[model samples]
Target chain A: MNRRSLVTIVSVSALTLTGCGQAGQGDVDNGDGPAEITMWTHSAGNPGELEVYEQIIADFNASQDDYQVVTEAFPQGAYNDAIVAAAAANDLPCLLDMDGPIVPNWAWAGYVQPLGLDPAITDSLLPTAVGIYQDEVYSAGYWDAALAIFARQSVLDDNGIRIPTVDEPWSLDEFDEALSTLQDAGYDTPLDIGAEDAGEWWSYAYSPMLQSAGGDLIDRDTMLTAEGALNGPEAVDFFTWFAGAFEQGWASDSGTIGNEEFNSDEVALSYTGVWNAMDSLDAVGDDLLILPPPDFGTGPAIGGGSWQWGISSTCSSPDGARAYLEFSFADEYITEFADNQVVIPATEGAAEASEHFSSDGDLRPFVELSQRFAVLRPETPAYPVISSTFEKAAKDIMNGADVGSTLDGAVAEIDTNIESNDGYGF
Target chain B: MTTDSLTERVVLRRRKVWSYTAMSALAVIFLFPLVFMVVSSLKPDSQILADIGSPQAFLPVGDISLDNYFGVFDRVPFGRFLFNSVLITVLTVGFGLIVNSMAGFALSRMRWRGRSLVLSLVIATLIVPFETVAVPMVYWVSKLPTLVMEGGMVKYDFGWLNSYHVQIVPFIANAFAIFLFTQYFSTIPKSLDEAARIDGANWFTIYRRIVAPLAGPAFATVAILTFLPAWNQYLWPLMVVQQESLRPVMVGMQYFFQLNTAWGEVMAYTSLITLPILIVFLSFQRAFVSSVAASGVKG
Candidate 1:
């Protein structure tokens, strides 16, 4: 061959190799022929979880002949961004594991399809697990978690303090006294509420404080009634006192500290979710103790749904997707998952299967606390606006801004957003 | 008179010492974060929190291991992610230089119709943020059906955000790159191209034989800028690639950080990701410094 022919041959050969490389490894079996269904889930870095999922997929493939599910995992942070882009590109997967907050958002944006759950399937889930928006069940939960307190048992014992139990939950005053004692013991900060970072602390620590003080960020009945309450005396009093703990050197000034900080014994207490208990225990090992969230009369505790699995709107095989969901929530699978993974289950069977809860510590406290005081965050499409508003107010408070004014501003911002988003009331 | 001369020499020496001190201080300030990142990655998670206020806490003193490095591999598909990143960066830089240089040469040297207008249009596109065009671009890419394989017609739905093409293709012929090349190519003597053409050489042959060989400094500039962005790209990659297997190091590192909140592991993974770039920079430090200096002089 001439030099030009050689060049052409080489280029064509290179192009052919590139094409072969692009053909991903997975045989599609969509009954009619071989079809590949791409599945995306938010479980990227957890090796243990990924392993289980791989097993599940293997089992699924073995049991089925119609379709092959090619699972792709992404971390929680990138999951939402990927979903939005995927939706825009019309390349959404056959199934997606999403957070509860995103379900309503995607549904409102008309990117999600209703599962149309049969009565048998719907009956198995917790009433609250049915994440409904606009009178449509957009998604269903596979796991549930509640805002609870995780404390270093060794630190509490060293300070001669008795940790609160589920039934005899510490009152707000008592909780403050315990924190003060720990602080006075020369531990620079007694609590790692993670106020600096806009995460669970807003829901677990600040929201509960507001609830205990007879103030709600959003009234459950009206959803609009709490604009005044956000900047009210009760709310301000709790925030100022909360800020005082930092001023008194009882809480770290760094707001970005997370549960891991507490788990590593950097702080004595962390107001985090029950779901973090296993991970925290893994970090600290045997020195950890679970406590009920502080109580203030009959007030609600900030709670929200955990992880949920849903079939994608663009899924090619709905039957295959439905079967997977059904199998995932089945008694045996939920039991095995909860037992092995240390996750809180969303179904009654899974909850009952907790007789086998093997964290070697009393797991009943978390279950009971979740049952009693757990109040779901507003499931409106406007919840992200609320979360951002809360985050801004929390940041302002942490930065020494006047709590009342900051919260008032946040409330106003949320109100404006709600009004602009067609004023969908709860 | 001799005593006075000796005293003057002493004064000059003192001034030199003062200047050296000032330069050292600036170097330390610039190097602090990088040094700290390296040290912190070696330390245990607990020590990171415990010694937050102490300089000693920055160093990995006790119980240091290669655990964090291993952790990165175990927690995420680090190897595959690295491979994907290498593939994307290599393709982007390699293809980018060829396409941009050709266009740059044409626009700057060749007398083509609407050359100035084309250059302006290319430059104008740079003003628009990628995010603003992302949704529309995704829509257009999804609608493109020609990319399908011929045999099965397995529609190559450009699922642009989820593949290598999205990350590398749109950015291959960057306006900045074209402009940089054009500026640098303009500096080259037109006589070289003219001489080559006088010998019966075609435009392609002239470009190959005369223009490209003389455009080394410009090519280096384009390669450096293009390669760095391709390597460090986060938002675009995060937006595009959902599959863990397809993600680059930045996206993989994010998952590793979140899943394993251990400071040591985080540091290790960060060090691993950053070490390659650091090594590359150090190896080509002279070229980088000279290129910047040359670019500054030209500007």
Candidate 2:
């Protein structure tokens, strides 16, 4: 062929391929073996969770004739990056699971579509477990995890410390006294707040404390900035005490990540989620006491939200994806997920039926904690940015940075980011 | 003469002793993490946590078992990930040595127009971090065409997503590899190439039989360097390859990093993945060290 003709042909083919790649995602129902519905999850290593997911997928596929659901499980640490990359390629799966706080950002970025879940399912879930932005439900989870102060009843009794309950959690003064009393009782570091945990964990594990101090990541009234809510008096109060925990040697930032410090008797108390409850119970037996988080001024609070399900914006068979979600949220599956993964089931019925969190169950208090004290992270499209910014500020405060200036700097950064993105559509 | 010679010998012996002591300490410091990982892999998580901040962490003295190894296999298909990593690394290194070495020969030994500018451009890419261009690269690769066998007929597929080639191809033509080869090949005597040409040999023949044989250290250096990155590839494979069957071992490390990380399993997986790299480095220790020393590059 002539050189010019060959060039023209190649260019045309290239453009054709580009267009086809974008259009190809929409061509799933071309009689290609039951309109394949691809689902992506972050349960690659958790055999318990992955088993439940596989069961759901198998049951859903067998229950259907028009659509077949397939799943791809990525490791939790790498799941977010994979989703972002796939969205860029227009190759996102029909069914995608994302962490709850990320729902708004992904929704605003056109990665996920707002769900139209039946209100029966939406109302059945813990309020914090349903991800909503601008009055639109974007995602819902099968389970929600709540954090608690894990203590041993025997130790508390021996140390002459009051056993705090869900109704009457330790106030700020009581908690401080308990830490001091434990420290004097020969436990060098009395609390394991998991300060060494990094990134989104800083926000997920600590922001509820900020809320309990009457501060928040952002002003939810406007959802435009973190000005007063973050750098205000209440936030400073929370952060000062947070830093003081480390400064006073009541907690150590160098300890292990999970309940190990508590399990090994290196620490008297552990600030951990329900995921660690089973391990602590295994070690401490009936002495394990899952106490509610300390109430600073407003009420006790624990960071709420966990991984949730959402449909990708570019899904070819979104209805089928929704069908799978709806099918997967049945009480039996939810209870099984709760029992196996040791997370609080999102629905009350499931919680009631759960082997781990039902009436008289070992970890029953977590259900009350999730119901009463669960505080959702700021739900705006600016959340991803807000989340990291809060993590940095909280980490700095924990490391003894000046609370006021650190919080102010964080507010400015968050405000600038929101403004830079036009308030992240508020 | 006897007194002076005896004093000098004594001084040399003391110096040898001091240097050996210092080197041994440094070696122990470096090997501490590896020992801890292997030892921790055999113990339960609780014991691993308890042994922290103590010398016992380095010793497998209590509860040494292969449970974590069994857990590693139960959690992930270690064999599949190992095969994928080996296949990708071998193919990448095998192809890389040929393609990059030739480019280096042409750039360094042959007379070509714009050769200097091309070499500068290739090296310039070294400054651009892979992360900065990862999204764009993902887009382009998704639009690229590939051939697929559909019912015994070769059909053109649009995207390279989820396939093995996506992991191997984009990484083969490495900028660092090319730069290493060009600099290494440049150090060889041009007289060898001229002699080969005098025998009426073509440029390809000279590159093959004359300069390439002399650039043994260069080939070894490039092979080792290419193998490391290929074996340790994480982000690219995670982005493009979605199938569990096609994932590399580095990405499999994430499997153990859940809300409550499986500490023992993490140590086990690291110890397992680390074996091949240790083997590769130890097998070519002398050649690798000599090449790096000659090239003045730190591995």
Q: Could you give candidate 1's per-residue lDDT for residues B1-299 as a string of tens digits?
A: 69999999999999999999999999999987777777777766666666667777556677667767777778877778778888788878987887898899889889978999999999998899978987777667555432435465444533334556667777788999999888888988999888888889888776667788887777877778888889988878777566566778888766754523667677777787887788878998888778767765332
Clash counts for all predictions: 6, 0
Off by over 4 Å in 2: A1-27, A30-32
Local error of candidate 1 at residue A137 (angstroms):
2.2
Fnat measured on candidate 2: 0.53
**Residue A180 CA error for candidate 1 (Å)?**
3.4
Candidate 1, residue A147: lDDT: 66
lDDT: worst 10-residue window of model 1 chain A: A17-26
Residue A15 of model 1 has an lDDT of 52
| Per-residue lDDT of model 2, residues A232-267, tens digit only | 999988889998989999988898888888987889
Query: Cα deviation in Å at residue A58, candidate 2?
Result: 1.1
Taking the tens digit of each residue's C-alpha lDDT, what string does model 2 give over B17-113? 9999999999999999999999999998888988999999999989999999999999999999999899789878876887788888888998979
TM-score for every candidate vs. truth?
0.88, 0.95
